[model samples]
Target: MNYRHVYHAGNFADVVKHVALVAILLHLKKKDAGFAVLDSHAGRGVYDLTGEEAARTGEARAGVARLMDLRDEMPPALATYLQLVKEGGPARYPGSPLLAARLLRTQDRLTAIEKHPEEFAALKDALAPYANAAVENGDGYARAVKLLPPPSRRGLVVFDPPFESPDEFETLAQAIRDAVRKFANGIFLIWYPIKSQAAADAFTGEVLAGGVQKALTVDTQISAPEGNLDRAGLLVINPPYGFDVEMYAAAEILAPLLRADIAVKWRAGTP
Candidate 1:
């Protein structure tokens, strides 16, 4: 419950996660029908990169900071993400909820849930400008199941949990199963830290064993897994068509820039 994203906003994982996020949202927009987005574990919607929390870690320096100078070199999907970050201003970084809100169309809707009270208040205010967006103070995982099969019948659910609990993997595995059962067609994206290869593999196995038909696992490692925070990944369930091709291209460019090893693979079905 003590986990806060302020210190880690705009870090490398955020870059990978948000790049894919923008790509998915763009895909959803291709159709004339409106869609909904549920940001489970939504943090404070926006963050000040210069604030004490960010300053303490300075993680963005190695992440978003490095990309700021190479805007012309980024691929289409990444360029879009970079543009969003640039719009947030040099010292400001938009979290997932804010990013979704900015990209949402008038016909679209967004529901962001943050369990932490302080973060929830910040999220509510940050999303207030969007009439189509709503903020709720509650457990995001639980909220995910309840909000599935949105009235739009087309939506995306992002699970960016703070894996502070030892059983987080198991918890997330079940959550994925439940979410898929409630809304099989909905896109589900999960962000996880790779502290140990064995644990990560086991977690992936558990999720696959839950009977999901299509899943993709993409990960980037800035360095060898010598510590707990060197690597991160995203497990995407029921991704949009051509998403893997586009994401692989983005990952190729991102890994070199960040000095990381990038691995993109389909866990359940062909791209």
Candidate 2:
């Protein structure tokens, strides 16, 4: 698997995913008890939108760049996301780990896992400033599962794999199964490309088949795909209360800028 997230770092899908992540983490923080976050397939943590890879695709221009002026009137989730983006500066973007790390409170902890050696090294440096965040080099899926029922007992497991292999969906489904079996109460966020709606739904069904109740899906369709992946979806198992509301609010702001048609649906239990 030679796939890298740098080229597509700050696209429309990423905007939605990261916004949802912020909402979830914020929800987790409301409680006094500590919560953990596992970022599987963690990238280099930070991305340079002006770099060669990002410029080649220019995905950021249509994604986070359009939200540079996001105002305080926006929902807290979007506002927090915008603040983090701004903190990274105009030419840089924060990946999941960096975003998650920055959001971590003293009581909360973050474990970021990356499969690529170089990405893992960069991940370490990116998270070095955060005493609450740890970086690991290994199979993100397996390592994340092994860290199940984290010491905190409550947490979020983020699976944002590259989906480079043919059995990517199957692997993701199994990982979710393992997560549910070991840590059913934990919140799980899984991202996947939607080249085929039917296939994507089937994969979602498989994950729900693992007995994941209270799950919701957030999807964005910027355009009908012509083989360049114009659509992607995120599955949130056990999403926090009002999570849908926050994501929808952020989507409304994002839709016009991206010309995207975003949908939020329940795959299992209701809000």
Candidate 3:
């Protein structure tokens, strides 16, 4: 409950997550049928990159700030993400909800869940203009399961928990099991901080044991080994066709700018 994303908005991890998100959303658009999106752990729909929190951390300076200058050099997916960030204005960056809202068609729907009171209020206000989207102040994990098998029958579910609780990883794994049981075909994306290679391996092992098919893990390490979070990863279950190739290409482009090592791999059960 104490975790707030304002300080780390648009950091290297955000770049990786949002870039992959943009790619997946674009893939969803290829079909004529409208699709829904559930943004579990959606923060305030937008963040101020120049705000006090952002300034104090200075994370974006080494993250989004570096990419803003290389617009033309980015891959199509990453370029699209950067353009969305730029459209948010000079000092602001769009969170997952806002980014998803921008890509949603009239027939599509988006539900953004935020449990934090103040953040929920802000999220409601930020998403007010989108009639196709709704902002709910509730537990994202619980809401995710309750809202599965959406009316559209085709959708994406994003889990971006804060990892504030010691058991968050286990909790997330359980949530995945519950959600997959209800909507087996739904695309699931889970993001986690990579503090160490061993920890990441253990988590990935647990997820692989969950029996999800076509799971791909994408990660980037921006700094040399230290006792801090210089790396982050995303686990995508049932990713879109060709998404793995596109994500690897995007990570290659982002690695040098952020001084990160990129690792792209297919976990067990992937096919």
Candidate 4:
């Protein structure tokens, strides 16, 4: 379940995660008051499919490359995500912070955190064009929580850490609980690998047990869990209204295209 970003850029998991991100941002835009976005564990902003890392996996070819066609009709969320990716130019894939920065309105702001020196440097340069975006080089799990309860009181916390450590699930679960305590009303988009159903369930259950009133999980399994990783999950806490429907639309169109089984389920409060 080692999901390093460069190797799997624009993969099925990223496609689904980013589509949900766009949908949530669109919903946030409905309000005149600007909201903030904190992208914890933000990668190097952009990935190159032509690079050796991506060529080795060729994951983008089977994931996002399959859906790159410009069509007349598509879900708003998917369409927007596709448009942004296309605008990034050929073989270049935008990471969470880049996508969030692109969607930020004039009044909005974004703070992207990366612990790795190389990634943090690249992320800083990548976000240089966006005046609304800021970059931080630090431990995402700890730094992200301290920035909670954003000044606007309206924001999204994107928590998708690289699970390099064996205890990453435990760390993420506790981080979510802490984040919720500080920013209970803020929207949270958390990502995790689904290597074991029981482990994934326990992780999500831990977050919910932290008094998170409303939450939903979007799961995608491209194939049975075998040698290569096939399943992943995105857990959204306090999702906006109609958020699930938008994701469902994206899933219907993506399942066949990506050859993945996608499901959106309410794990806590009613939709």
Candidate 5:
């Protein structure tokens, strides 16, 4: 089955991806110098929870709904993500583009790319309100390499492909390496699914061999690898100053709610 992101828009995978996305975006906000955000495979930038796709899966009910229910009591990182969701109301979700756009100051810029025609249109529409945000309809993998080392020389790049094709692994890995080669100093965040321990681990090895100086991989195993909802992970290169600490606190709160055998680990050459 093709994995339409709308079906899993706010699910556990998204929870991990979005929360980490928010954390890194927050770090970019700390500095006075203007920064940029390039979202590869940006999805639609917004999802209608009440639509046929989302309603059919009802995944958001479990993901975003659960997050919303616990918003008032959530840890700091989760609470921040929830704050953005709350702005969209119960019927919608703010994808990474919107989330990063909200955090951007006048000096900051955002360029989001999506290949799916329908989703790309929605991405443009979703970001139409932001004067500094640009939404593109094209191949994210290709765009990532072209948009790297932006003029600002400081920014975060998010690679969140649909992973519809198996070859996406090699493509994503090389695309990341290409982007890093041009801007090793910029922060890179790659979101991926946890299909199996070995597959995911091997991918991490590929990322390591890609030449990023400081990198961290965070994987959460929610269930046995028997179903689509099994697991998810995020790879960060040149991570924010305090991502690990904040992610640990966020994971502890989410683990009990997810009710999965979850663990968080860090593997890198630096603090």
Candidate 6:
């Protein structure tokens, strides 16, 4: 569907994805050990909500705007994610790169990949403040494998694809599988839209059948997929011990406030 992330900048899908991304990265940072972050399909890194595309639909109004509007009453986890967004005002949205760079330690490095030349330039500019970041303009699906096990062998890979095609799902699953085989200790966070229950189910099946240890699938939907963007999800491989609990609490706290019929579900296969 030629889904450009620009139009959907701070929408519910972005909310679900970025919140989970921040949560995972934060958990990884809790330890004294340094870790690297590999962001594949990382969009321009930061988005201006006041821009033409964002102003056109004002999607953030119902997405991140709603979250910020309810910030004071949210649980700690939800609060943490919203805190970052609120920092930049409703006019700017922090994409994955900005999120990671904000929380990463000096020793922690970040590798961001964006294929679109224009967006890649924006991504580079957005990440310029961080001395530890490296921006690559290319197809991340290929780079993820090529850059497996980052330098530290301790890190998380963030996959936030535009999902222009369904085949991208299989490719994402395979890349995670390949990465895990190469760096068994690293974590992988993959974001996807919940267009159909069947699609979500199929992706979950792929993760389980791949024999990935400590895998979790957390999904949130505001409505049944019927003519509108209805849901968002994150597939977490090797998540930290208590991450699912935090994610559950965040979802519960966010559902009612952000409700378009938002529902949260999660499952872990014998990790």
Best by lDDT: 4
* Tens digit of per-residue lDDT, candidate 4, span 1-271: 3546898888899899999999999999999999999999999999887789887887788789999774757878899999999998646689999999999999999999998888888899999999999999999989999999899999899999988899999999999999999999999999999999999999998899999899999999996334656999999999999999999888989999999999999999998
**Which residue pairs show collisions in model 6?**
none
Tell me the alpha-carbon RMSD of every candidate.
1.5, 1.2, 1.6, 1.7, 1.9, 2.2
- Kindly report which residue pairs in candidate 4 clash with one another: none
Put down candidate 1 lDDT per residue, 4-30, tens digits, no spaces: 898788888888999999999989999
Instruction: Give the poorly placed runs of model 5, Cα more than 4 Å off.
Output: 71-75, 224-226
- Model 2 lDDT at residue 60: 81
Q: What are the per-residue Cα lDDT tens digits for candidate 6 across 1-271?
A: 2666777888777787777787788787788888989998888878878788887776666678776557356545567778888887766688888888877888899999999988898999989999999999898978987898887888898888887775978887787777777878788888888778898888877775776767777776675334657777778888876777777777776677667544434455443
Instruction: Supply candidate 4's per-residue lDDT for 85.
Output: 93
- lDDT (0 to 1) per candidate: 0.88, 0.89, 0.87, 0.91, 0.82, 0.78
Give the higher-TM-score candidate: 2 or 5: 2
Candidate 4, residue 137: lDDT: 92
- Residues 119-230, candidate 3, lDDT per residue (tens digit)? 9999999899999999899999999999998999998999999999988888888898889888888998899987668877888777777777778888887773345468
> Could you give candidate 2's per-residue lDDT for residues 1-271 as a string of tens digits?
4888888888898999999999999899899999999998899999889889888887888888888765647988888988999988856689999999998989999999998888888889999999999999999989999999899999899999998998999999998899889998999999999989888989998988888878999889987335567999999999998998888888888899788999999879887
Sorted on TM-score, best first, the list reads 2, 4, 1, 3, 5, 6
| Model 5 clashing residue pairs (backbone) | none
What residue runs in model 2 are displaced by over 4 Å at the alpha carbon?
224-226
Q: In model 3, which range of ten residues has the least summed lDDT?
A: 220-229
Better-scoring candidate (TM-score), 1 or 5: 1
Of 3 and 4, which scores higher on lDDT? Answer: 4
Could you tell which candidate, 1 or 4, scores higher by TM-score? 4
